[model samples]
Target: MSQRQVVQVFEQYQKSRTQFVQTVAELATRPMNIEILQNAGVMSLLRPLLLDIVPTIQQTAALALGRLANYNDDLAEAVVKGDILPQLVYSLAEQNRFYKKAAAFVLRAVAKHSPELAQSVVDCGALDALVICLEEFDPGVKEAAAWALGYIARHNAELAQAVVDAGAVPLLVLCIQEPELSLKRIAASALSDICKHSPELAQTVVDAGAIAHLAQMILNPDAKLKRQVFSALSQIAKHSVDLAEMVVEAEIFPAVLTCLKDTDEYVQKNVATLIREIAKHTPELSQLIVNAGGVAAVVDYIGNTKGNVRLPGIMMLGYVAAHSENLAMAVVISKGVVQLAITLSEEPEDHIQAAAAWALGQIGRHTPEHAKAVAVANVLPRLLEAYLRAGATEDLQTKSKKALKNILQKCVHLPALEPLLHDAPPNILKHVVGQFSKVLPHDSKARKLFVTSGGLKKIQEIKAEPGSALIEYINTINNCYPEEIVRYYSPGYSDSLLDRVEQYIPA
Candidate 1:
């Protein structure tokens, strides 16, 4: 088709505005086509038609601009320069209350992707107008204004600061205080942005008495609202250590702990993350989390969590475990937690199992009492079995190796297996062979596998196995372990190891 034919067809289509609206909807996801349509000059002519259609056509025009925002810079420029903003602003002021919200909503969509335009709207006293819209009895208009203010505040810190300076904080805080969960969510999110730039603004929220409201929102029947409140809690948690203290002091840990088990992984994650953040910087709060059954909760959840939740869960648990020996010991003492942790070592998720292993290792390192406890727990063999099951894949193997290495290095002395120096478990003997065969260099005294009761002797017997995986396993260990350990320690049958052992052996 010729350019004029394309233009004429488009014009004919625009004349039937319902079809035009549907056409724009169809093109909403096709940015390039939206650009082609917009740059084709059809949108410029359609703009006047859209304004004439006014409230009825505003959504379609705004949506088209949003799509055009992606590639048709000229169209974005035109929508900004044309009658759309004035019409949107006027629509908010129109006597028809329903259209007031509809117009503000369209403006929100337009401003979301076009920050310069949003800021320009703000500059033209749109901020004040939106603040006024917030006073309307209609929840929809109030919601839209909250969103628009947030988008504007996010894009223009200066504008955001100005809004706060103009007393938007108290209004937004009250939005969170509103009985409606949807409005509360939007209000909290907008407030989060405001808090990010000025953590001090949290006091403004608190002074508005949002803390108790937020704490109660955590118990909201709607899971989505609970999540929003939790997110707001986290954002505030990022501020004054005092805020986290207040949250914890409110006996809110149990509620936050309940969120750990929420079927919604996003809620679980945000709650887990907030717990971690609070526990990290505040020892008093960390102790409270510990006392409130936080450690046991995390250990239980790590066993069942998937995807993103697993990693963050592991990280938080690890941080807590590493942060305090008492916390680590608390987890270790929780009923069946060792068994739970051991079971985690068998999961398909390498990071999850690795984290479990790391936490166990840290516990073992922090308190030597766990060495025998862990050995009798039979977690080591389970980990080895998991390693063989999933360790063939590169990612899984890295996780497995790191976890195994940590457990070995941290165990320091595996007393339950000390008798193994005389009678080794077949698989433990095989593991010894594997470590020796790899010969991976070991820099630290802790990397030595020989410290386990019969671990060194077990390697010798494996080397003697005429046709065993033991031989290959030893070879692999040799390739990876420190040469001195292999050369000097492998000598039950090696002249060099005997001499070196004698020299190092104290009288």
Candidate 2:
């Protein structure tokens, strides 16, 4: 063959290989084509191309593999079983920046599916290669490697510790401080994924001076970067009291409170969640949030938002109030209960309603004053209504019932207790009756209203079993009213003599 003819044939071969990989990359973008591509024995065809003499063909093949593995776990396992991972990991260290990015992406795609799949990537020494990629001069390589490391570490603690063992933490910490916005975002997210698995892991990130760097990024103008920074802080704060205190010591509170009103809803939610995590550990932490007006910011966020965005705000109130009666009062002073009552009554999702119920319970469970605060918002009836509805979730019913019992045991407000007598079921009715038993014996006007409003008649119809607390409360309330009136309202009395004017006799 002539030399010119041989060169023409080689060029044709490279062109076809390039077209095949590029076509697969385009087809991979549509999820519906994954099975079609796999059925065409794409993995068998693509495996040999990972080591193509031309770098574009190699990188594009890796890109196609990453997309296939990213679509689902079965395809990810296909990449693993086809022996594609080992070849990619081997090429990852020797490749150019684009190939390194593509190979690291494939590793991340496989590892993100499950711990076993991730362990397979680890077994192929992908972490060592990816860690080396993080040290590359190219920013894109660093970002891709950080993202892959985060995915590998995200599955569980063992895998996370494995990434730590590969010496990725200090590199990732340096990546967060880099001038590139995308790198900072990805690196912060990677740090959060690393630290979220355990207290010890979080301490590792903290010891690397991550909190100070992350806290400084909170002031960055980029919305996405701010989201990751707040997320890292929240994860670190959630692990333990000492860790939570470390986050607070960074002086991120009032700055985070300002973010509660930020235009970004996620920023608002993460800020509330971070505050809640800090407040959840101890009374002193709760007081720190209260002192910073964190409760009020959360209250405003809850008021303006809907669905899941407001959930963190609602829970922050619960955590703050759960710490002590004084913090509970702080929530009440901020109009937190009213917002929670609104959410419980007006929100569409059952889980959100359940969260609001749980929050209101926290606010009202502390003391009589707190109970009255919740009662004044008219949350009691809404809670009872939600609890009794047939479609309410078991979680909602359980939380609502517990809230009722908690507040009712502390409530001194007679007017709020009256409406519940008309509709409460036996488990909840006992609480209503018990609250009345406490108040009616002391207040004559309330006792008179209890009868005139047919509340006493409502109690009479309950016919609680012998020696039950409902019956005991009934007896206590019965003694507070006139015996004749009580006997008239008692079961079977009206049936006995209402029609017999000439001869009236009790049953």
- lDDT scores of the candidates, listed in order: 0.63, 0.91
In model 2, what lDDT does residue 386 have?
A: 86
* Candidate 2: C-alpha lDDT: 0.91
lDDT of 1 by residue, 441-490 (tens): 44334335443434544454443465677666656545555566555455
Q: Which pairs of residues collide in model 2?
A: none
TM-score of 1: 0.66
For model 2, residues 1-507, the per-residue Cα lDDT tens digits are 999999999999999999999999999999889999989999889999998999999999999999999999999999999988989888888879999999999999999999999999999999889999889999999999999999999989999999999999999999998999999999999999998989999999999999999999787889899899999999999999999999999998788888888898888788888888898999999998889888888899999899999988888889889889999999999999888999998998999999899989988998989999999899999999989999889999999999998899899898888889888888888888998999899998998888888998888898789998888999999898778998898888877775675576657
Candidate 2, residue 456: how far the Cα is off, in Å: 2.8
lDDT, residue 177, model 2: 83
Question: Ten residues in a row with the worst lDDT in model 2?
Answer: 497-506
